[model samples]
Target: MPRAPNEKAETAKQMYLEGQKMVDIAAALDIPEGTIRSWKNRYKWNATLQKDNRNVAKKCGAPVGNKNAAGGPPGNKKAEKFGFFSKYLPPETKEIFDAVQDADPIDLLWHQIQIQYAAIVRAQRIMYVEDQEDSTKVTSMESAGSEAYMVQMAWDKQASFLQAQSRAMKTLQGLFKQYDELLKSDLATEEQKARIDRLRAEIAKVEAENKERAGGEQPGDDGFLEALNGSAVEDWADED
Candidate 1:
């Protein structure tokens, strides 16, 4: 009497098997191309997509590699040999590491990190000073005492740069610790560890110089932060 729904689906499947594109099959059966593709995907019929029958090898019993393709060993020896480290760090990560090989990766990364940290400290100080400066301008000072208070506040902010230098020192120390841990573990290679050690020494020297400068000066206005935040913030706030 009536054909089964499964029977209709099977017939559609057979049409797909018999050299029919998804679009052609969908048009013929009044079904969507997505439905046809779904059917093909469910059945794992990969051959229907190929233009030539030569490329359509057996799905279950296929050779590992083609004999025609060149060289002694087909797969990459370097990738296969590197075990867990290679599995986590694929070719793409290795390529990035390779690109920065000439310069010390640890040193470069630490410098970048320190630069970012210094920028942040400088920014915070700038914001604080601008807020104080704006307050001085906005408030009506009837006395020299009020004027002196505003001046002191500005001076305090300039001096706070010395305090911020300590923060920079702490940041470098933390990074050094992290770099040391990373190097000591199996995560990085010997070359990476050596570079990290070299970078650590350079960073330590920089921090020491900054410490000496901060210690030698007065606490608030005349320190390292003032020098950095000087005309830059003035220009930034002026622009805004």
Candidate 2:
């Protein structure tokens, strides 16, 4: 016996999923676009597409701190690009990067730690802290005045820098822990995704209403940052 009339709907779904546009799928399947659209609406194709995109992004190594890694499985164009671009990466960085080829959440957290540590280095460089060393040698009290001041200044600078670095590391470690927990989270089910979508729609509707009431003005990213700060997101996150 034939499988069922609903099998055609399944076939239509597969064609739509495999990169076929609605019109093209409808034409090829000899079905009206409206009928295909109805099948798509019934089956929630958008969520399916989002999941597929996430899988593709993972396979493509989509900019998750490992874009410059050398080599990959053969015949994949993304792998070929990764192979070509990775050689240009700095040798010192490559040595550390190549030592571990895993993309697990723990590996990602390790990379985040390195990046946060380098941020401290960059902050030091921006402040020209490298030239802060003192070589003044003072022995006699008469000659000690200027040299003592220089030595004390140098000591204070070093002490301040060390304190800043210590505080930054502690803050960054906590943030990375939160991110690692997020990364280790299991994928959301369709029901959860739908609920999230509905909540987002509600928020967007309120935003639109507010924008309209305020002479069509909307807040840019700066405003969002100010709001976040006012909301204490940064304070709660341990940011200074």
Candidate 3:
């Protein structure tokens, strides 16, 4: 069932539309600043402000006898884009679209890179294998007088982990490549360019160390540990 809207959220939205800062609104309403900010983003207060501004302008159109008061032709579709979106899109999705409309493409790509990298790093812990003897067992079926069990040997788990990690790494690498390409454009700042270089260097160092520990074996080999002990992922997590 859908939850009912909170009255406090509505009050916060009104306060925000009145040009109040999130922190100030939080103080006024006895709510946490983080909560206020979340509501602002979730409900897209900025988009609401834009609509209100347009309505205000329409209400107070140019004074009489002013040539500048001549607006766009009657059939103008200048405002149709927002209208169409509002009519068809769910509130949450429309809010996200409104929020990202002014975001830089480079910044957006970088955010994806961070997210992908984090996922890859987190998988190491979830899919960790202690040794060849380690295995996973689960009940496959249960019946009135019979039962079935499925057991995955350590090697099988390791192989599956390697396959999944390899796919995840490829996705991360693709994001890195896209970010690097975007960084080459003039719109990129020095800090943004430096971030990719630093990340690439850290990841390369980790891979090299892992290779050494594995006796230089290729990925998915029995000797490889998937760089489970590397601090590169830890550093990335700390940064985030």
Candidate 4:
């Protein structure tokens, strides 16, 4: 006699199709293994799951019968964890973000600067598209003028963003200069300062000596000495 369609069998079939072994599924679901095995055989669960797996792999362009090394299938947990945002961002922005993601003061400053810069670029693109875009083809001349005004307003916003960005950079420069002065005030001892001054003096002396030597010699002096010494050595060799 055919058992009526029921919840237990349906549950058993679902667990078996999910790649769980019959014994484990039976243990976890508190059902007998023989009953689950019966459900598996009756529902043709293995064949159905195999077909589904092959279909999934084909859709993802993965070779048949090969499990992914990173895990099973594309868009698996690991790949998303590693680079979920990589393809969505512009290459240069992605590169800048990646390079500065964990870096220090420069990263913070770069982040501050790029926020305004990105806003300016977005505003410019909007303005460009608006200017070139035909306004529904049925727009009145006044509407066209209004659209032009809107684009010009967006362009004005972009200019404001750029000027703000420049002011931010200059402010950041001053802040950094103050920071450097603070670090120097706390960290530099008199001895280190004296040594630094002495090193600078020595570098200046060496640079001056090099400059003097470079211009002091006549252009042909080295060649003339070489020729004069060459004949003297030959005469000495002939005497020997």
Candidate 5:
């Protein structure tokens, strides 16, 4: 006796809801992905389209946050500051992020960079406080000359660190650009590839529009600095 047609369909529907891919569901049920996809289209088996609803995708289809590192600290706050970008990532990519979770190398590196930036901030704050303390002490000193010398040295070091940070950020941005290109070139899903291309074209269009807007007069140093300071990059994640 053969199984009823609806019985098999029920099994497929259950598997699909359990987060099985169309291909895997098909294989498990001795059907093709196309056939499974057809059933999916007709019945809406994989109906959850919202990224927040799905498990993060991994190449190996593993569970999320199963890293080898021992749990110690609760979280990295500086990285938490860039949460806005995570919200905007394509649903599929976020699924991938969810899939890898704490095990993803890129995620770890991004957190490391955040820690580094926090350290830089701390150093800058300490330098400022030290200079203030020195100034207060200088008021009682017989020599006003030594006060200026020490302050100058502190300012020089602060300037150097700020310059290094600016350079490092530029380098990181370049690396992210390359990483996005490589993802499109080597690892991007069909949907991801098409979307990235579209975004690139849009960015080009925006840049051209900006140039036109600044016609006859290029943005001055102040305007450029203002633009930089106001950029949405401040809110975006270090993912790229």
Candidate 6:
């Protein structure tokens, strides 16, 4: 049998339709803001709200042949663009488009930075190797009564982790470069620039400490693996 819908979710949907912000709805209903956001995304609340608005506008639309109410208000093409997208795109994609339509480029890049940084930090714990003896064995294939297992030795796993970390750090560095370029533009706020600068300083400090530990010599490939194993990376992870 199909499960019943959540009562709070229904109430939240009604509040959303009535033009309440998600945070406000969460506060009023004593729900977590994350839950409210999840419900909004899962239920296509923005699309529903837009559909309702269109319905109301259709009902109260200007009289036929009235030249005064023409061309969708001055310089406003959002309705037409949104209509096109709504007709052609899936609800989830449309929601993402609407969400990021007016977002600042620098802010968008910062969000990517946060996501990439968090992923890199998370990989450390997932791919950690205690010593040379530590290894992982997984069943690679199974058919009928026969099975094939793949054993990843400690050094092999560590090498794989290092390579993956290298690629991730390269992507992260590229993001930082893009962010720096964006910050050079007038559109970026002082706060946005400062945050990137601070993060860069923190990363550089960690890298320097790692180099110092390795006989004060700068290693090639940006010392990413060295920084990855350092304790300071955990502190950086906490910032996210």
**Candidate 3 backbone collisions, by pair:** none
| CA lDDT for candidate 4 | 0.50
Candidate 3 vs candidate 5: the TM-score winner is: 3
Q: How do the residues 1-240 of candidate 3 rate in per-residue lDDT, one tens digit apiece?
A: 999999999988986786666765665555788999899899998899999899877875666787755766887753443345545666678668778977988888888888877887777778888888899899999999898999999988987887776666556656766877888788899988988777767766677786788678544432222332232333323322
> On TM-score, who's better, 3 or 4?
3
RMSD of each: 17.0, 24.3, 12.8, 26.2, 19.3, 12.4
What would the TM-scores of all predictions be?
0.29, 0.27, 0.53, 0.24, 0.25, 0.54
Arranged by TM-score with the best first, the candidates are: 6, 3, 1, 2, 5, 4
Q: Model 3 segments beyond 4 Å from truth?
A: 1-81, 204-240
Over 32-79, each residue of candidate 6 has an lDDT whose tens digit, in order, gives: 879989998998989988987888778766678878645557878544
Q: What is the Cα-based TM-score of model 2?
A: 0.27
Please give the CA lDDT of all the candidate structures.
Answer: 0.53, 0.54, 0.70, 0.50, 0.49, 0.73
Q: Tens digit of lDDT per residue, candidate 1, span 1-240?
A: 885556546766776665455565564455787987787788666655463354555444446786634543665543232333333455577556556757755657666656755675565556455444533333435685555223346656544644665455445446656766666666577776676556446645554576688675333333333323232333223322
lDDT of 5 by residue, 1-240 (tens): 985567777777776665556655654455777887787788766565434255444235445876635443677532222233333555477556556665634434444544544553454455442442233222334474553322345546545545554554554455445545556445345654454346446545555676678773233211222222224334322223
Model 5 residue-pair collision total:
6
Q: Model 5 — which ten-residue stretch has the worst lDDT?
A: 220-229
lDDT of 4 by residue, 147-194 (tens): 432333544544444444344334434543443453365544565335
- Give the CA lDDT, 0 to 100, for residue 133 in model 1: 56
Off by over 4 Å in 4: 1-4, 61-240
lDDT of 2: 0.54
- Which of the predicted structures, 4 or 6, would earn the higher TM-score when compared with the native? 6
Candidate 6: pairs in clash: none
* Greater-TM-score candidate between 1 and 4: 1
* Model 2 clash number: 0
Clash pairs, candidate 5, are: 56-95, 56-98, 56-99, 57-95, 57-96, 176-240
* Model 3 backbone overlap count: 0
